[model samples]
Every structure is written in structure tokens, then in C-alpha cells.
Target chain A: MVGVRVDGTTRLMGIIGDPISQARTPQAINPIFAGKGADIVCVPLHVPADDLATVWAGLKAMPNLIGFGVTLPHKQIVPQLCDSLDPLAARIGAVNVVRREPDGRFRGYQFDGQGFVRGLIAQGVVLQGRDALMIGAGGAAVAIAFALQQAGIARLVVANRTFDKAEALARAVNEATGTSFATAGAPTPESGQLVVNATSLGLNDSDPLPLDVSMLQAGMTVAEVIAKPEITALLRAAEQRGAAIHSGIHMITGQVSLIADHMIAALG
Target chain B: MVGVRVDGTTRLMGIIGDPISQARTPQAINPIFAGKGADIVCVPLHVPADDLATVWAGLKAMPNLIGFGVTLPHKQIVPQLCDSLDPLAARIGAVNVVRREPDGRFRGYQFDGQGFVRGLIAQGVVLQGRDALMIGAGGAAVAIAFALQQAGIARLVVANRTFDKAEALARAVNEATGTSFATAGAPTPESGQLVVNATSLGLNDSDPLPLDVSMLQAGMTVAEVIAKPEITALLRAAEQRGAAIHSGIHMITGQVSLIADHMIAALG
Candidate 1:
């Protein structure tokens, strides 16, 4: 209980995921939720993948539940459940946070995109006129990439184990915004100003490296989207290589605050 | 920003319902969630009836959501959302609350059944050896009738506009609880000692009356489940006739504390 909750006066925020015990949201954002109000609390809800519909019927029935953050598996599914969704959230094809209204309706939003943008700013990394290397083309990676353009990154490259998925995502983002800030390939010859690893690899104690962190260079900013086991192997390796590091924890904290603020505003 | 929330030291509780705004759980239970260092905050989550599966998926994914007092439209549906459900909730064919664990699994329980029993005891009304009259076979009424038997009522007569549903619910409670208190049809000849109106007979300004006080005896006790218009016409009439009355507001308050306690014990 000592480390589980925030002090009084904080508002409430939460992230829902399957296998929630392994999530980092509880540890990273509960404090921030408390910091904002000392009256707030952030909780992690583990909703099963199969019974999503039935449980949802009952959850929305409770008048006291304010809003919730969605995670893997459910993230993509949340958009379809919304009566009306944020344009960006719908375009991103997933939602990491939702705002519940007085009418028992949930409006979906993708905070992860904006959160990462805020993260870059927090670490003094300027996104404008910068070329970046983003590893993986998964949900988190895609969301982060979408957020990157908003932060003014001029050019980008997306590297992944599966070239097709990466290419599809890059093409989608490019086609949607016509900004052409993202691309797909293997570890290529083009150097980048910022490099980010978004895959789950390098997270577990025994997981393999998803990307060549060795490709990182001096003066280049490196970031890892993995929050738990806070210092993933790739991040440590990046640090060892003298690359400036902007941890994903910053993104999580910023996102929690942003999501809570958004929900509060929506509620009002 | 200025309200109670469940943190590490706080407990968790919820009031489950769709269209949750019409319910008043935050007012009744938030104080209790804060009373014992349990940073409980009740949120109003509006789950669309069609998107039930998605809502459940979102809810089960979080690690912090605990118990809840489920409400209208979802009472019957909540039981299916759980991996394990209370027999009483299962028997009543409904659930009003669910308990989530640290591991993120949700277990369903029907607190309305027990809360109603406690409401009777708090008023020093012993159900044992006392004949009772229950009006309506709706969600709340069914729960109250099941609870009455648990309190040792001698016999119960269920009355409803649709007499068949009331008779059916009475039979269901009798079969599942193994209590002989349930009976078909409405109370006849005013023979019941304890009369209860669980329908929305006296709500807002012009709600219809469900019970006829014409045959009420002076020593009999009458209870109403309507929270607003606390002084219901039936209860008021019973009071005028020198009969004791347990206002619906008392039931609402009792249920909130009961649910908060359930969460504290379950989550702690």
C-alpha cells in the first residue's frame, strides 16, 4: 500500500490491459496522477480479451467510473466501440485513453502519440527539421511515429523485422498526412538525428535484440519505448555507446498527465 | 480534482450501470471510501449496450478496479462478465458489483442482496417469523426478496403489475436459497407484517403507486426502495396510519457502505 497509491488531492487516471500485472503504467503514472491533485489515483484494470463485450455492458453501467486508459489487444478494439471518436485517434487506428461522459458514452483518444511528442520536448530534443530512425512498425511504434510529425520531424525511417508491416504503416501515415516524414527499410545507410526502438525485444531478461543499437552514433538521441525493466538492454547499450538517451518513462508520465487533463476537460 | 481516490492505501469500489449519470453513488459512498484510508473513487463509465464486449475487455485489463454496486440494465448481464460469480448473484440472474484482484481478474458479487438484509437489521426490523409483502419483481425487488429470506422471514408474498414475473422470481429465490419464504401472488387480506415496495412507485413528481395502503395494519412496517421522494406516498401513508417506515434513502446509503466495505475486505 505504501508505494501503491498517491497522496490526497490528486485526480484519478488508469490504464486497462490484459496481463496487467506486468504493466508499467501503475508504477509510472500513479504518482503523476497524485501530483496533479494529490486527490487523484491511477489504477490498472485487467480486462479479458474474450469477455470484453459483456463486462463492458456492466462497467459503463456504473455511474462512478470516470474514464480509463486502454492497452495492448484492447487498444485497437476500443475505437470500434466508440460512438464518435477523435479524428486523430480514428486515423491512428487505436486508442490508449478514453473519456466517459455523463451520458455513459466513451469518446476515444490516442494520447500515446502526443505523449511521446511531449517526451521529446521534455528531454530538450527538438523534433523540427530533424531526421529520425524508428524501429518496429507495431502499434506503439506507429503511434509514436504519428506523434513525431506533429512535433516537426522533417524526415524519418522505419526499420523492422517484417518489412511489409513497416512499409504499410509508413505508407499509411504518409498518405494520411501527405508529410512523407516516415519510411521503411532494414538497418540502412542513411544516418538519423534521433533513433527510437519501439519493439518488445530487449525488454525481458532473455529477449533478443530487435534492432542494432550499435547503429547509434554520438550526438544522436536514442529512446526506448519499454517502460518496465526501465533500462532495457538496447538502452543500456545506447548509453554505453555515448549516445544521448531520452527514456520512455518521460513519455509515460507526460501521457498520463495529458490524458487525465483531457478526460477532466471532457467531463466538464 | 477535489475528491477521494483509491491509492496504495486506499480501497476500491464501483457502482455498475449503463447510463450511470442517473445514479447517485459518489454522494453516498465516496465519504466511506475515504473514511478508512481507502482512496476509493467511484467513476461513471458509460458502456454502450451494443459494445458490451469491448467494455468488458477494457475493464478486465486494468489492475486497480475493485468492487462495484451495479445498477439498472446491467444487473443481469454482469454475472457473465466474471470468471467466478457469487451464487446469490448467479441465482438472482443478475449482479450489481464485481471484485477485481491485484492479479487483475474480476469476480462478480451481488451486494444488493446482502445490503437489503442489512438495511432491515439496522432498522431493528427482524424478518424472522414475520410475514412480508414485496411489491414488484424488478431488479431491486428480486434482490430484496432474496435478502429477506436470508434474514429469516417467515413467508413472503410478491406483488407486481405482471404477476407472473413476480411469481417466477419468488419461485427462483425459493429454489436457489433453500428458504421457504417465497410465495406466488400479492399479499392477500393484508396478512403480511412487513410490506416492501421495490418498484418506482413514487419517483420524480408523478410516478405511479405500486402498493395499496388500504389494508395496512398499524403495527406493520413498510419500506420503499426509491431514493428520491424519500418520503414516498406509500411510506407516508403507512406512517400516517401509525405504521413504521424505512425510507428508500436509507437503503441507498446502506448499500453504499456495504459495497465500500466489501471492496475493502476484498481488495485488502
Candidate 2:
């Protein structure tokens, strides 16, 4: 899309989140739009949590706004605001991507969990019949937990600062999937074969690790959901203790093409 | 703004109109943004007349949207929708530009008339004490009429398809300027020394001239507000009749810097 200009015919896509200044969606996805030579651009929308309803109404009225990416605090909340949702998004109880139909109806979709799973699988980490331990019961945690189960994980343990939240999330996933493997528990050395940090604890330097580093074993594999630093304290500590480590950037990289394709497919 | 990217921190400005495909504001003012190295980009938003209110609400809620340019049918309607209006905008009863304040309030401003006057003056077409004949009584006509009066024009005859509309616009301008120089009239051979087309008639190829071209004579200066075609039918006819013809692009060129400066000043 060399020489492409932001003219009237250009369609718009935006990523909505609070504290949006640190987002990499535009940098990661806009180039893909250019690569396809499509007259579409992605922008960042800094929307506060309280004003989400107002902003959502406004976005629905924009005929040229194809859709937007959901992140952080918006992912779980936007599900109720959407007109409809795919089964995966509905089951996960979270949406990371949305598409606006021609009739102005917003349809929600979940790609975060699938992207993370694909990223790990692409690196040759098998999830089939493997036991996994995940931190946090938030939006990302819910989506990833469901995806890990769908990927044929044998046993899963959910950990969170609030034990009730972890318990509720585990119960929902089990009920939705008709499985009895998931349960709320604390992080321990023998928790599972796969240790995942689906929390924001690694986003800032002052933040503590999502789980105790001493619990990581030499044969374990650790993964993260925070991408900015590329190397979180947990990942660093896991590496120092000889556990296999995966950076958070791979999750975004794995789904960048899928998101771009889904957004522009209808335009054609 | 060399190598500028549409990242999270980049602020946005847009031109909103129904037929926004023809708008040149993005092409004209985006370079000005780059020249100043401001991380602000202008995009064209194809918002229909019915969706203006919804889009306005959306833009106000967006913390990073600096403002937008108003055009065509939106100019007149947006005045009432603004949170506040400048004296000039209130006087003209229209707004061609808007700035969103830090507190999410939209401030409307008018520059069409001043820009036209400045463009003519820059070209040495003196309007002081001269009589002018303007076509149409819409948003642009009203703005230019008041600007012509403010430029010390001795008389201004406003001609529109609806005589009542012309009369109303003339009455408003005259009362606002505290002068009885502007009045509703028809275009004749000896209407005024300055003949201007302030309507959308010259936009398409098959459209008739706003005024009778046979009335154009030698020594008369014909100007336009339609900038897409540098040489409109009126200007071409005026040129053939040995009259000085002014291109519509000058109107936008005259005020481009003023608009860009006003939009970005508050940001600094």
C-alpha cells in the first residue's frame, strides 16, 4: 500500500482499552493491511472503563468503522454489549475481537486463547493430555483456560489472588466443557507440567511475579500473556532455573495475520 | 513528522460529510501537520447526515480526537449541536471547523468568509467599497456575505433559488453587521463588480451554472467556493468574457494554515 493516504474511502479499525498508549496492535496489524494493499488503517482508542457504553454506542453508529480489537479491561465486559457472539467467545465468556456487520450489528469473536495455543503448538509444545497450571481468573485467563481444555489437557489448576474468582472460573470452564479436571488451587512445585502466567503482574517493573519462582521445576515450561517487556521477571526466573520459556510476543505474532484477514475479508 | 506512524499516542482529526470522498482537507492539512512535526493525522469520515449526532458523540468521547472539519449539509446543522460557538461562528450561523477541548466540550469556529476575502485580497482583487453579487443563501453564502460586508463592501446582492432563503440570509447578515448593504436580488448584467458562485452547482459536469453566464462582463471578478475543479464552468465562462477569474482552491489555501494552527495550538 505504498503511497496510500487516509482518504474518505479508507475504512477504519481501532483497538479500545484504558491506558492505550502502550498498545502494539497498530504497529503489528497496520503493516499487514499495507501488505495486502488494502485501503484500511488501524488506530488506537483510549477509552475509559466508565465510558465504554457511551463509546460503544458511538462506534456502532459509524458506518465506515469495520470493527475494533478488544483488550485488557474491555475484553470480558464487551461480550455483554455485543449483538451476538461465536460459540467459542460465548463459552470462554470473553471477546478479544469484534466485527461490525453492514446492518450495524457488532459480532464478537475470541482469538487470544487460540492465538496463544497456536503459538505454543507452533513451537512444538504438545498440549494433548498434558497437565497445566494457569494464574489469574481475569479475561485472558478465562479465554486461555477454555482453550487449553479444548486442546486436550488432562488436568488443569486455576490460581488467582482471589480464591473465589479462581474457583468460579474453574467451575464455569468445567460446566461449559463437561469436564472434571479443572479446580481452584495454589501454585506449588508439583502443580502441573505446563505453568502459565495469564496475569498483568509482569507489565510493570514494580509488580511482583504472578507465582513463586521457587515452584518452577527444571522440566516445566512457562508462558506469559504480557508482551511489552518480551521478558518478564517470571520468564527470566523460570529460565534461570532451567525451565523452558515462551515470550508473550509470540501470541500476538501468531494471530496478527488471522485478525487482519478477518477484518478485511468482508470488505472485499 | 518524518517516518510518522499511526501509533497509540498519535491524535486524530477528521473531515465529516456525506460525500466525503471528494474532500481534500486530509491531503491539504496533513502535510501541514507533518511540516510542524506534529503527531496528528487527518482522515476523512464518510458520515451520513442522519449519523452526525452519533458520530459527534463518539468523537467527543474520544480523548485523542483533536477536532474535525465540517462540510456541506453538516455545516449549518452542527452549529446548534456545538457545546459553544465563537462570535464569528454564531454571527454567521454556521461552523466549518471545530475543536474539542480538554473537558470534552466542542468549540465551533467559522473561517469560510475570512478565507475567501483573504484569498481575493492576496490576489490583489480589492473589495473595499465595491459592490458584490453572491449566488446561493446556504452556509457558504451566509459566511461569505458577512465576510464581504466585513471587508467593507458597499453592497451585496444575495441570489438563491428560494427568494425567501436569500432574504433571510441577507436580513441576518445586515442585522449582524449593523448595515443595510446586503439585500435579496437576482443576477443581472449589471449586478455588481464582484460576481461569486457560493453554491454546489459547479461540482458536477452536467450541472448548470449558478448564475446566468451571459451576465458576466469584462473587468468583473468571478470567484468560487467549490475547490475540486480548479476551473469551474462559471470561472471558464468568466475567463472567456475577459473577466478576472479566481480559482476555488485559493479559498482553502488561504485558510489551511489558520485551521491547522488553531487545531494544534491547544495541544501544545
Candidate 3:
């Protein structure tokens, strides 16, 4: 938690979600504001799905609120509510953050994919011309898949339990990027240079691995999207096979600064 | 300023007003929450008049919000927007605080008058059967006037620049309490046992006294409603006239704990 001295003049920001007690954005970003001596405080708002529209209208009318972050059940539905969307966010059909403009219009932006890519790059992992195998066709997978393509990946094989959803995501990415760079297929850990577990498989100790750990190659790199355990079973197996590993925590650490910067830049 | 550690689980309360930068509630009440080690934080929300309805809707939908305080232009209009109001608040047609029930209904409560009377009583300035001369007939004056009658004040003389407004307030209080203990009249400093300066005249240094200080006798006690410049010109002159003077800061000090207790009690 951040030590904040909130007063009448302090600017406001928050993360809106249902079952919001588990959200970490407030703890992650409030420290950045405090360190910079910025008079901004980020709190959590537990707004149910039915109340989003009413809450949004009130947020717009708040003169001192700079912006707020969207999470879980809200990312996809929030884009339509935004006054404008970043071109990439529009193409991806999801938004993870929204900034309030001086004219009182809210512009949405997608940072999940960008955060994943930035996290990998910051860790010195190469993405250009790499052949990657991504598991799952959920929201996180969709964002990461597009980001991998944008980062100059030679090809991407999207693997999921429901093959139809995976194929749909691959086709959408290909159509938007104007390249035959994505395909729907089963996860082949031995063949791909990079493997990403974007599913919730690693969240619990009893959960099965998203891919074949035995097929993991010595030179391959395995990454995960489950942040709670930090070292997921899949990543542990991959490391034992002499492969490099990346934890899902980086996705959050990589975006906290970006989220704070986006909201502060709009203040000027 | 209170040092607050804000996280997702912290319950929220705030002060709502236009030009809210001058509100002292946040600074006053947050420390009480922190002192009790309670996971409750009080912030400030600047909601303009036109957006009150929209903001009120949003606040009701926030599951983690316990309640909020209403100030300035909002105090009088908020009662009608409430699902229910304390009988005294409805009678006075004003509310300074509100609590959100678990069932989602918002109930408004008035504490301004109680606070003023409590402040005087806390300092051992007796109110039982006292003859008092109260200046001004504004919102604060109205709350204080009704409270004084409830506290068993023998008689209350309501005075204002506009005589009609004073008469109307006196008539309303008398009718509601079923007592002929209040009247509309000019401020006669020498006649009353207690003199209350409820007008805004004592706010600025260059302004005239709410009543003639020459007639303020040694036995009479003078009280004020202006918190800033704790000792107003009227208070200073009354002190020089050998009268017991009470500063306005006690009103806030007297009510802060009461407000906090009201919101927290509903949480159970």
C-alpha cells in the first residue's frame, strides 16, 4: 500500500471491477504518484456489470478525475462506451485503460499486449522473426497474439482447447495486419522457438500443463500469464529442460509505469 | 493531513461539494479512521450542481462506499434525492451526511445543528432554558435554531437582514416543535443570556459585527459559526466587553466523531 495524504485538491483515479479486492493497480500505481510528489490517488471501485454506464456518466462529470483502468469483465465492453479508441485498441476490440480529455471526452487505449511485449523486450528476449506458439484464445491471449505479430514475429500458432475460437482470433489478426502471419493449430513445444501459456492452467497446483513439457527444447523460451505462483509448473519444467523462462508478474510491472504516464500526460 | 494507506479493501467516504478544495472534512475525519486502525478512507469529491443526480446514482452503485458528507449548496437539495431522511433533517429540509444501507437505499442525516449545540454544551456553556438571540436565517442558522429548541432553550429570537426570512424560519420551528418559544426580532445583545453570530458577517476582517458590541454585557456569552480566523471580530469585541466568547472551531470538532460513528455503525 502507498502512504497517501489525500485532501480536497488531490486529483482522483481508480480501477473499476467486480470483486475488486484482488485488484493490484491501486497498490502498484499510487506509489509512483507519491514518489513523483503528484497529488493523485488511485483507489478501487467495486462497480458491478449493470452499473458501468451510470458510473461512467458520473466519472465524466467529475472535473478532477484524470482517468481509470479497466479489468476482467470490462475490457471488451468498455471500448463501445469510450468516445474514441486508439487505432490498435479499436482493431483488437478491447481496452485496458481510459483517459479523460480536456474537452470531457474519454479515449480508450489497449496496454495488455504492449505490456507483455515490453516486459519480454525489457528482459532481453528477442521477438523479431521468431516463431511463437501461444496457448488459449481468451482475452489475454488475443492481446498477446496481436502484440507478437506487431513486434515482427515471423509466424504465430494460436493453440486453444476450443479450436474454433483460436481460428477466429488468428483470422482476425491476419485480416487486420494484412499478412498471413497467424494460424490455428495444436501446441508443438518442440518446434516453436518461443512458447507462451496464456491460459489459467497454472493458477492452481493441481491444474494440468497447457503444453507438453517433455517436448520443451533446450534453446526454447517459455513464458506464463499466471502471476500468483510466479514460478508456474510449466515454467519450472521448461527451466529444468535448460530453457529460459519469463513470469507473468512482468506484465503488471511493465505496465504500471505506462498507465501512470498515460494519465499524467493527459493532465497537461 | 492524515497518513492513509489506501488499498482495494479500504472502505470509502468523501465530502461532496462544488469548489470542494476548501472543505476540511477530509483532513478532520481521516485521522480518526487511521487512529482506530480502521480500513476506511475519506476522500474529497468535487461534484457540481448540475451533475449531482448523476453522481448520486454512481455513488449508490458503488458497493464499497459506506457513505459521504454533503456541504455548501448540496446540503439543502440532497434530502429529496435520498430514499429516506431522518425526521429532523426532513423537517429542516437539509442534510449534511448520508449513509448507504446494505439493501442499497441511501438515508440522509442532519448533524449541523446538533454539532453547534454539542460544541457549546461540550465547553460547559449551558443551553437548558437559556434565552438566546441568534443572528441570520440561512441554512446553518435554520439547523442551529431547530436544534436549540430541541435542546430545551426557553426562547430563540431569529434575526436577519431580510426580516421575512427570519419570521418564516421562526414560524416553521415553532409549528414543528409545537411550542411558542421562537420569534422573529432584531438582535438585542443586552437582553439575551446567550448571543450567537450565525451570519457570514464575521468571516472577513473588514466586515461589521453581526450585532452592536457596546451592549454585550459581562454576563452574556457570545458564540460564532465562522471556523476560519477562529476568533472573529465579533468574538474579539465581545471578549473585550468582558463576555465569555466561544470560537467556531468546536462545532467541527464536536461532530467529526459523530459523523464517523454514524457511517461505521451502518457497516455492521
DockQ of each: 0.13, 0.37, 0.61
* Candidate 3 lDDT over residue span B1-268, tens digit each: 6578888798889789998888888878889888877788888888999999999999888889888999877987899899999998898788999889878799999998888888898999988978999999998899999889988889999989999999999999989988888899988865548899898997888898898889897888999989988999999999998999999998887788778877888878
TM-score of chain B of each: 0.88, 0.85, 0.94
Q: Candidate 2 residues A21-92, lDDT tens each?
A: 877788788888888987787888888888888888877877778899988679879999999998989887
Q: What is the C-alpha lDDT profile of model 1 across A18-81, one tens digit per residue?
A: 7665556555555554455443446655567775665555456544455677876788787887
Top candidate by TM-score: 3
Best by DockQ: 3
Best by lDDT: 3
Q: Is candidate 1 or candidate 3 better by TM-score?
A: 3
Candidate 3, residues A128-205, lDDT tens digits: the string is 988999999988888898889988889999999999999999998999889999999988875548899999998999
Chain A TM-score (model 1)? 0.85
**TM-score per model over all chains:** 0.58, 0.82, 0.90
Which ten-residue region of model 3 chain B has the weakest summed lDDT? B186-195
Docking level of model 3: medium
Report how far off residue A69 is in candidate 1 (Å).
2.3
Q: Chain A TM-scores, all candidates?
A: 0.85, 0.84, 0.93
Q: Which ten residues in a row have the lowest lDDT in candidate 1 chain A?
A: A1-10
Between candidates 2 and 3, name the one with more favorable lDDT: 3
For candidate 1, the docking band is incorrect
